[model samples]
Target chain A: MTKTRLTRRALLAGTAAAATAATLKAPAIAQNAPIKIGVITDRVANSAMWATLMGEGVELATKQVNDAGGVLGRRIELAWEDDQDRPDVSATRARKLIGDGVVMILSLSSSTAAQQAQTATLEGKVPHMSPSHSADTLTTRLNNPYFFQMGPLASFQIRTLMAYAGTRFRRVALLTDNSALGTVNATSFRQGLQQGNIQIVADETFERGVTDVTPALQRVRAANPEGIFHAGILGAEMALFFRTYHQMGLRQPVLGSFNLSIPTYLDLVPGLLEGVQFIDVYDDVKPEVVDFANRYKAVHNKDPFSLPAYGYDGIMLTVDALRRAGAPDREKLRDAMHATRNYTAVIGARGTTIGFAPDRRIGFPENGCVVRTIANNKHGHAVWRGLAAS
Target chain B: MTDLLELAVSILEAGGIYALMALAYLVVLRPTGIINFAVGEWATLASFFSVATLGWWNLPYIPGAVLALAGVAAIGALTEQATVRPMIERGAPILTPILILLGMVVVYREAAALGFGTQNLRVPPPLGFGRIDLGPIAIPMQSAVVIAVSGIMLAGTWAFFERTIWGKAFQAVAIDRVAAGLMGINLRLVAAFSFAGGAAIAGTAGVLQAPLTSAHYLMGLPLAIKGFSALVIGGVGRVEGCILGGLVLAACERLVMRYAPIPSGFAIGVPLLLMILFLLVRPTGLIGARGRT
Candidate 1:
């Protein structure tokens, strides 16, 4: 009877030990450390509408990765910071994000602010991605392996516009506001036109906030260019220009930058903006674009602007790099980012096979622009594709 | 030469409006010894109200003009009574009254922004759109009307001050408020009258300029700067000097743009350069006293 009792006690002890081993192994399999991605944007917490859309993108991307069994059995976590459209503020935010163990950072907007964050990211050896800023200097002159841009650079868009203008118009005139962005676009456009064997009849600049553009437009009219291209955001100046241009009896075709099709421009000018053409990276009518837009609308109850799409794609690209790297190591991630060959994004098809060739750190697909023309003053229709060379 | 002539006409039209705004500033400055920084705000507010009256309410232009002018004048008088009169009663210094006007400027600008969104509105010109040709030079008909109205108002103002009893009372109050009060002139009434008149003139300028350049909350700042610059250049507190200064500044800017080797965008810099030159050479301005009081 004593022997049987001792055997029963040994069997009970074995069962207890087995249960403890299984519990410990379950945690190892179920609870992988989350990969932390730092998303620094100017949209969230600053503007209500932008905050919601951009926030949803980060949230959606994180959820998608987690739902798909995550990267290497580890779920993704996004830590966001608002730059508030200031460079100094963004730099401080980027440092804080780096200190918090974020492997990569995503900039919300503004080329100037992104450059500021990029400097900090390079110092910290953390990768930074910008969704909307297209400044060539960010990608070319300050080519840091840690930095990648998801949108087409300003030079690319300007070259495409100049190519089209060379074929259609004999002489092109440039009218730009006296802003940093405007000046860069104007200079790039001039260089592109020259390269394309097109002549510039006139180039004029106006004060940043000038409401009355009649005087400037009158001077441009005296030059009698085949077409006029205005490089500025659409607001009061755009409305004033259209009204004054119509009043002055100038029927020359007007081309504008991507800002021409923004909601503010449509709301302000209404019927006056008909027949205007602009260059954009994404068109809402395209199947891929429409699907994303509808999903964005369904989720956020508002149509997504081009900025949010770039932002979403930027986050996804970072995830792609992480997957390729197999870990969150800085050097490996940078290599994976640079080696991206052909990766499709919500904005358009981003070639993963093509990426930052050590010399070019910015990740932008060539021929990313699609030409859109205003049809009924309310909506813009895409008319051309693949203007920039691949 | 033809281009120069065309520019001159343009300058005259712009100058006429500036001169009117300057005169409005002088009307308040001469009587109250206070520079109403809110003068342009008053004009901006009146222009917006005029648009609301005509466009939103579907009233005729004449009624809208009258209502806007009268309403702005009343606001001016009330503001003086509520804000300025108490300070004057407390025997505050001259700068204190000026500061009050500066505060009013901020309040008025914010109020306008709150009342009307930041979007620019199109205000149709009061006169029909057409150009009147003066031989080789053609000018907008609106320009002629602005000049004519300014001349009539200036002449009427001169007559009132020089010939009428109430105008004499106003001048007496302006020259010496204590003495005017001792002589049984109602000091408060005269002060209110000056503010109302100044505001009305500003309202007229607003009504005139709105049709050419649409109304916006921020439009007042540049206009105020130009009007004040004219006031300083023409000799502070002098109506005729203000008019002359406005015309000279506008003409010089236009002429510089037409003939200067620099681009037209740099035209504003010319007036600023002239202002600096004038300050260095003739501190008293073209018509002001040579030395400090």
Candidate 2:
């Protein structure tokens, strides 16, 4: 009977009123929808050799957060993509993830891939974090406010390592594989040595996957440096370095970058790494790390060493920020991430905390870097802590 | 002079590895005329299997290595049957199969990575990591064993080609696939067997080279490149050429790295330079392909 009196204008007004009502109710339905987080991991690229472990770390953290009841009373659902370690693909994947209503993205691919993904993340106004990349240029290459890096920078590791070993060897040799990251590490290590006023006796690089470096090692032996500072990450090449080192009967102490901190070497070089020392974040015996290691052991039946702890800390901190933001809104959540301080993570020294200050995008403290010795072919005791003064 | 002597002995071990990798390519290329770039992945897969059997499952070295080789051979044969055979049957150009084989390289590589995670799996050298001294010259124990095993493999492959019926069939197919088929040679069988043998050779090289390079998913590409370079320098026609090419390539690389005034990084290009020189001087390689009856 009421509709019998309806005109075209009245009908249009009624439909508009109903549409507005549905729009108002949309937020209530979205409130219970799971918070979407994206992770770009590489499983097919060369970086996958280490990225797999980092991705596993990311997986475990996401699992723990979900098991503990996700943020803001909404379940946290993770969207995963493989970047194939290509920077272009990485940017494309980042855009795809951001387009899918993701609040934030974690790049667990190569540093360059992560760096490239920043373009998309910045454009989308989504907070992005490279939780385990150590490329110094990752932060400085772009002035994007949305990007934060938590990995120990090469400069920090180099300086800390120099503080521990530079005084003992005034003349050092720089060695690395021809990998992009390997070259980057070696360059910084050279700088770190120069800053310490140490003479660089020889510089060498070997191709990855080649079985023989004895030819190259012969030259290093001829140089007769007091120490060999290596920055290689390829397990095979790294092991070859050690094998060639021993084969040539060279007795120089081999100091390494954080690459040695990875547990793969223990399985690879084995008996070869007796007196080798390398730089790392800190001791794994810290209470937080022990807990993380225990959790890892419960599932994997083997205690994790260095990489997974970083992932756990990254996710835990991100979750805390999301909670502090009180909603999954991107701007508010990024602000909360920016305001973070005094946060605890399983990475770095026991007392060292990860946070963003007003002027710094690097979350890992400079002094948090440590130098550890390989004992029994394991990531051994931390012999020194904090960054070395220039 | 002492350093030079030490360096010379090291090349024997390095060259043997490149030789086997070259043989892997040759084994497939001879019968089907398709350059199987996937040989490196086959090698890597075998290395992973050997690691699993010997390291993880605690199988004895002989059985583990054998199982790995046999399994990869089967996979290689299956690959030919699945991919190569169908293309040939459909009258596809040789380039089609070569392109397809390139695609298989990625497939096999990703399969390897998925099947075996990227952890560094060490295949402990059968001979311990000690040094063996040849009078004034010194060699790693693993290197000597690897060189000896490589020699035996080369001899065995030589005997097969020169003395066995199947090897003759392989050669005949390489000479003329259609004519060989007309002569009652099973083209499919030849193709499959050649692929299997090629893959096994690759597996052998991988296991032997593990001491130096270690085993990982990413280990294949470099092996493929080195082998390809050796192939280019050695020529594909003669089995002996593979060994010759590998030795020359290794010698060039080592000599450059050790004696060249250039930085160690530049030494990497020595193999390519040598290959190019060979191409210019002897386009057919150091050992020209002999006419097979």
Q: Write the residue-wise lDDT of candidate 1 on B96-181 in tens digits.
A: 98898999987887687667755556555566556676787666666677677767776687678778999777777677777889
Per-prediction DockQ, in order? 0.10, 0.66
lDDT score, candidate 2, position A155: 86
For candidate 2, write residues A1-390 as lDDT tens digits: 556667766988999999998888664425588889898988887687667787667778888877776778777788999999999999999999999999889888788899899999999999999888888888898998999898888888888887777789888889998887888888888888998999988888887676788878878878889999998777888888888788778999988888788878887878889888887874676788888888888877887766777667778888989999999999988888888897878888767888999887889888887778878767776777776532
Residue-level lDDT tens digits of model 2 in B1-293? 77878777778877888889999999898888899899899889999888887778878778888998999999999999999989989999999889999999889888887887767778877777888877887788888888898888888998898899988888888887779999999988888889999999999998888756677888888888889889889998767989998898888888888888877878777777877887888888878776642
Error of 1 at A146 (Å): 6.5
What lDDT score belongs to each candidate, Candidate 1 first? 0.71, 0.84
**Once model 1 is optimally superposed onto the true structure by TM-score, how far is the C-alpha of residue B39 displaced, in angstroms?**
4.5
Model 1 is docked with a DockQ of 0.10
Task: Please give me the DockQ of candidate 2 compared with the native complex.
Answer: 0.66
Q: Candidate 1 regions off by >4 Å?
A: A1-135, A138-152, A208-215, A263-274, A292-366, A388-390, B1-6, B36-59, B62-174, B181-217, B284-293
